[model samples]
Target: MDVPGPERRLAAVLAADMVGFSRLMEADETGTLARLKTHRIELIDPAIAKNRGRIIKTTGDGMLVEFHSIVDAVLCATEVQHRMMRRNSDVSPARWIQFRIGINLGDVIVEGDDIFGDGVNVAARLETLAEPGGICVSSAVRDQLGERLDGVEFEDIGEQIVKNIARPIRVFRVRLQQDARSPPDKMADTVAQIGRKPSIAVLPLVNMSGDQEQEFFADGLTEDVITELSRFHDLLVISRNSSFVYKGKAVKVQEVARELGVDYLLEGSVRKVGDRIRVTVQLIDAESDRHIWAERYDRKLEDVFAIQDEITCAIVATMAGRVEAATHDRAKRKPTDNMAAYECVLAAKVLHHRSAREDNAQALRLLDRALALDPNYAHAHAWKGCVLGQTWVYNWCEDRDATFQQVAAELETALALDDNDSDVHRILAAVNLNREDHDKAAYHQERALALNPNYDLIVVQQGELLTWLGLPEEGIDWIKKAMRLNPYHPERFWNHLGRACYCAEKYAEAAEAFSRITRPDHTHHAFLAATFAQMGSAVAAAAHAAEVVKREPGFTVATYLATQHYKREIDRRRHEAGLLKAGLPA
Candidate 1:
């Protein structure tokens, strides 16, 4: 009796090929072939057998394998990879036999111990996407083997438009353990990629001023120095949030270097007296824990900002000689003539970062005071707009329409005062996003990036903006770049990353991303709920849904969708469907 139709069943398909095999053979044909055969017989075959994966077929340099369990297939690939790494550890780089592997979980047509379908083609395409010694897997493979794969992390690489794939497939790079390799794809977007330029962190300057009220001045000086240092093309300045983690705590320079992953550390103290201001600064080699340079400046109070500029120029010249005129212009631009206004902005910035309602109110008041002192203060005006923009994000505004209008007005004034101010453009971009003005938002974002490419906040917002603009793949790259620039970035970065994951329809990755956030809010819980719902985990989805409602009782899918900034109607509909499945209020 003939079997009914062709046999079809879901299976894990793994495709792998040795990297540069042709070149290896061209260099040393006999030895290359012998080494390849020896590896297959000694390592690859045994690993496949142990993991219960069947070897379907093999070319001289590639193989297609099948497994009843996606987990087994992935495990086999990883085990083989580990053994290969150990075997090639002592081998010369030119003679190393690196393999790229790809796995997919899909329905396959079977006939007489052979299989063929889109599944195999997709796996082959994915194999080409991976690095010489890395693994790339389809989203389905990641979904099938979730957290069950211990010591492994599937970093979402976003939807890839591979050859012959009917649609873009969400792909993930499989990472084993803590050490991340510099694959070509990842290195392109990484700021700290292999052989980065000199990296430095400017620690918060200690306030040596007799009056406690002038502490803001000291903090402002540190921030200004950090900003000035960032303008230098050769220097990688750690973001303020990352550098300030050691504030008011006793710490060693080497410890800070280890924590922040920087090569240099700059420390200073600011002291103010009746008629004169004195500053002490020192640059330390973090790895050696030795002071490389030290300086002291005593200047009249009227020349405080100039003192900052001089100190910056000195540091830059010390770090890399021959500073450009444009660098001086960027480092020395005065925010406001009135020092009181500068202090007001510094105080408000601290409050703004807190993000609590009371803190927002305080920050708004300080920004108003700063603007009152100097109406043309572009930074103050920009921050005012940012505060208003946050009101919309955190649902703090009673009259959202009025708040949006006010935000637009403030940002416009800031732009008019100084178009080069990245913060002004960034705030305007956020305002445009809230108003659903996608093109304008993107334009402002591009301007922001142009003004300050290395600014962590601006860089990550580029990612967030792109994700909301229906280009999650590019957004993921930008966000990863931001992380690379600031290793100790704030927790909110993970939130943006998680949202990017969800936007790409990789729910398992999205849920894991949200879970890893240091502090999860209603939005985070809601995302987790939707992600779990997409994966058909009813219990997990219900639990996360409850968490969202528990945090905000009136939370509903409709309300949530209304607040989202997704440009495409289809994307919003997709998100809505997940929330609905999670039993969130419509």
Candidate 2:
């Protein structure tokens, strides 16, 4: 027994893990598992084998491999990362399958298809430090691979104190340069082409309150920061929808900037503990992966607005050289002095976006509490109108007529309280559009646009308004711009685009746009039927017509046309004819 010693050898270890594995699994367990299997069979396993590496073990979302050569380990990791980026090009950013890989060269103990020691442990720790779709290596690995790989560079992140490691380990991030044969990173190039003004994206602030229910508070804070920054017209701010895709994900600042087409990124966390709140924010120059500015504020909960204002001013000053008086004034304006009311509004907003019947009811209750706490809160009133309008539009309430009237009253009260709130004007514009008050809708739309030109909701509504005003081509352009402003925009934007295309008599394009929706609802089916009918695809039109009727038996061309706010009689008649031609009851 004394003569029997464990086999020991020097080896290069690689640890790789999927980013946001738990989140992806929770979203779609079956699909995620299938995709993982496909990736392993098609790309990962083959790459490791090709690089002369042997997989020691694999967990549900991660793997550990041993390589004879440090150069082989580095080559395999970098190759997989770049290939993964290409594989994810067609996938939504939120659903992207990205990997974080780490490599180290150290002595290891080998035992029956498994290896153990500081080599494997260090690699695992380094993997945790790697960004999604990135690779990190310890100093030993970096030294071994010096000048071996062409078009590859190492970025020194300095020493990192990793978990369970007694001593600090020096870390280096692997950066790959673009090859001449490869296609350009369009979003990365967009940063330079978007004009001289700097572009920035505000990622959703992390909720550090130790309670999942408080996520809305952090989200509200992040949105308020984005809104404040957007008021500085000199800066191009990415919309909330596009920026929020990175929420709760481990992302590289460079990857995020490339994806969002922004020159800068603002990321932070919110910790609301007891009556005190702590906010930590950092402004990063994405291209250089450098922190342009950073700050931490510890204040009472009541001083949250002041903290936001300070953060906004600091960022503006750091990026643009200075903040204007108007921008400062705008950032300093608080929606409500009552903290409880602001929290209520924040919670309500999260519920409203869920679009569930129970969530809609809960949102209304929260808004009621908000109004009760501060009746003069313009945002609360405006949000109350939005919720009621949702109820009317989605048939969530029993008394549709009464809800519609209440919506108008709440919006009117909100506008009177604070005419400067962009959201108030945006909601009012929507209400007026639904009521066929084109002139009022136009005025509010203009006001909303002027107040916050970067706001996606307002910009999209301009397209809707233009479409209804018989300017289909211009409406199409505006809609496309809105989509550009928020790449992860709601599916309804496609519906808007489809409708505008139909109005413009581009039936084929209209059909194509409608096809982009994963699950077409009854209204979507109706539009699709009309689009196909106009294109003389009678069979396709009839099939979609059947789907519409199956979903909503009472649906008819006359009733649908009656609800549409087409300013021109010709447009109305054209849509009516298409529906009838599609075999929809008139």
lDDT of each: 0.79, 0.81
Candidate 2, 119-176: lDDT as tens digits: 8999999999999899999999989888988867899999999899999999999986
Q: Give the per-residue Cα lDDT of candidate 1 at 222.
A: 79
Tens-place lDDT digits, model 1, residues 23-49: 999999998997787577546887788
Best by lDDT: 2
Model 1 residue 280 CA deviation in Å: 22
Off by over 4 Å in 2: 1-340
Question: What TM-score against the true fold does each predicted structure earn?
Answer: 0.46, 0.46
State residue 141's C-alpha deviation in candidate 2, in Å. 86
Q: Candidate 1: global Cα-lDDT?
A: 0.79
lDDT value for model 2: 0.81
Superposed Cα deviation of residue 10, candidate 2 (Å): 99
